[model samples]
Target chain A: MGTENLVRKLPNDIGGDEAGKIERVEHELLPWEKRCHALADVLDFHKIINTEEKRRGVESLGAEMIGKLSYYERWIVAFANILFQKGILTPGELAVKMSEVEGRFSDVPDTRQS
Target chain B: MSEQHDHDHDHDHDHDHAPITVDEKPGYFDLMETAVRELLIERKLFGADEIRRQIEVLDSRTPALGAKVVARAWTDADFKSRLLENGRTGCEELGITFYDDTQLIVLENTPAVHNLIVCTLCSCYPRPVLGLPPDWYKLKPYRARAVYEPRAVLEEFGTSIPDDVEIRVSDSTAIIRYLVLPMRPVGTEHLNEAQLADLVTRDAMIGVIQVGYDREAA
Candidate 1:
């Protein structure tokens, strides 16, 4: 119920699969990865962008990795994961990548993680 | 059944996101986009106009950029060596900065088999060089299939590998990833850069599409 309360305020895109999994970095991952993973958790706030009307049924919860989750969320996490793997990208660069692919016309997409 | 998709197409359609207005002034959400854009700008992260310029650059790109990268590898020995040495730099030399120049790694198709790429996690793609991914590539069908059933995925895109040639499917999960520079086609020797570049479509370079004869002239 507490998780539901946390997600209920979201604009509709950041709900499903986010429960428990979307915890604060200090409490999210194991302490071993708390440093970098926590840093990544900080960037997770950008999930708000997923609220754009163009996207539907997208969920950023780790559960979205399942095909059953909304395609938009799955793609978003996947896109984020790509940026993570591509070393040297700051959070700002990641945001730029998102803006570029926000449309069908832009060349940015996950097919080329670069 | 053939009727399956028809039934799926009947899924609910919500209009809350697309409220109509006379002259269609920016809606609350468009205002939101503006706000977000402004926030990013206000923070001095990136300018709104720079984003527009990036869009313009993406729109203007052609498959030729990839083709030149591929052709240079094919012709000049020094370039080929560099491509082999570092695919990212190779892309830069050919005017393609896939990912930041430091982040990309280009993989080539060998005589024994071909290569194709999939993000598996999401559509992690190289927008800098290849441009926006095709709609199908962005679909769950492609993402799911590209991993567990790469051969099947390739088949859907009209590409198939002979059993003799190894079909290597590279998952671009990390920055140091690979691109499938498809093997040269038959009877295409001596093709000029323009013609050669024509062979390098985003899909072909990804190995979803095969290297084909210069059929455009026909």
Candidate 2:
């Protein structure tokens, strides 16, 4: 495996390797995450949270530009959708994102053992 | 971190076919969940369906529909005052319930101090209004840290409470739950009830995000 350009991302407590692992998984699952855009166009979380055309304007940006938002923004967009779609954010909801792979950039392998 | 969990029902912890980028499999929430579930069932503590049934029961309350209540309150000061006094009842009027399992705590968001609510123990929440808890909110760190240092946590979310505004962290334990009733946004006296509801997000109400600021109008 090439070690030159492995962009690492993770929680505060986890180390670089750990963060990198999660980031790799998240990236693999969604290299170009656009559930937020779908939420804006279909589910509509952007307007609900920010209450505006620009702030919640994930629609106009298109998947091309949305693919460019920071990982945090992408997560936030999903977060907004959670608040919108469901009246409350529920436990184990994160699994939904990991599973949703329609038109995604990376294909993360679901290694969750049951 | 090992506990007991017996899963008599069909459980799904299948994250198998992800990608090469996900090298180390940082964490497996299901592993812990299974252990805990097995322990409970083995101990005759609870069946999987009982726990699921409990959530189903809690979700039956009226306050679970939060935004509708907030929108109504934002537009009606009288109702807002009622909400401050009794969040559950106020929610009831708007067809919201705190659910049957948990006691609901309503933390009003004032001008001086913004109230941010998080669950430190488990994912204890005002399910009636808020409905379900977020994935990250159930984690150990978010549960523990958010209460101790609300400001630091908010900073991570890209929100920093001003020095002038005091930050209040409310942690809902097993029985008690809290909700942040956001301060009414300024220059919106003329807006209708529908317009105001558009602005009151669950994030602002929970304090992860703050209301917008308008300097020019000020």
Candidate 3:
């Protein structure tokens, strides 16, 4: 489809429900969100690159992944990738660590509810 | 999202921006972030203490800080000029630090123009001043529509601009964060700075709502 035609179909097109119906949802912060915040703070100390560079690396992960991941989740992924690239952490080690975390949390009840 | 441009001039083109959608359940992202954080801590790359400290810093911030700055600017012409000239320095003059490298650009609302802020890519907010961004600000619908139909967005927030006023939507990025300095409401001349600050709401600073005095109370 042409770019102009695509733009015309956007929700913001005149008379669309895009703007008027957008209600804000208030959800409790998920565990991942808390983890992301912590990870973001940790990543702040890295002298290798700036926040913009880290953001670019996350954006380079393609729109599908970008859209799927939450805001700070993207930051963690970018930080992991940067660490891997710098040889601070190896892919093999990270994969093993990820499996370990998954195994550790598999039996725990989901804490999303109080 | 590829169409990148600075705030130098207005762009006339209308483009289809995609909405940011995510799954309800935790998935790879959660596991990845956990694994990465644990690994980093174990490796001594950064300590748990440092992470906690950072979170503490973020937790201490709230919209009240922005309101204080706005209230000061409202009553002080010199401070207002300083804020308009350089937001970072202006904030520093009031003892409000940037807290990070991200540049803070305060957009002033006037009779001729109304300003709205959004981070289409991600929720890049001025954490030091405004605390965390509200959920709606990070949602897909708002991110997609705020730039394209700002007037309608404002209307949804109960803010109606006159036809003569122009709306400028500022899309924030990782490098620069925006804070909207709403015009002080009328009938507030008698109010002191503390009283003025009381009138400022988080939504008002985000430009989704206008700051106004309660007519019945006055």
Winning candidate number (lDDT): 3
**DockQ of predicted candidate 1:** 0.04
Scored by lDDT, model 2 comes in at 0.50
Model 3 spans > 4 angstroms off:
A1-20, A101-114, B1-31
Report, for every candidate in turn, its global Cα lDDT versus the true structure.
0.50, 0.50, 0.74
Candidate 2 C-alpha lDDT tens digits along A37-105: 222222221233332332334333344444465433533444434343545433444344433321132
Clashing pairs in 3: none
lDDT of 3 at B88: 81
Report how far residue A86 has shifted in candidate 3, in Å. 3.2
RMSD list, candidates in order: 15.3, 17.0, 12.7
Q: Chain A of model 1, TM-score against the native?
A: 0.24
Ordered list by lDDT, greatest first: 3, 2, 1
Off by over 4 Å in 1: A1-114, B1-29, B98-102, B214-217
Per-model TM against the reference? 0.59, 0.49, 0.78
Error of 1 at B77 (Å): 2.9
Q: Candidate 3 DockQ category? A: acceptable
Q: What range of 10 consecutive residues in model 1 chain A has the weakest lDDT sum?
A: A15-24
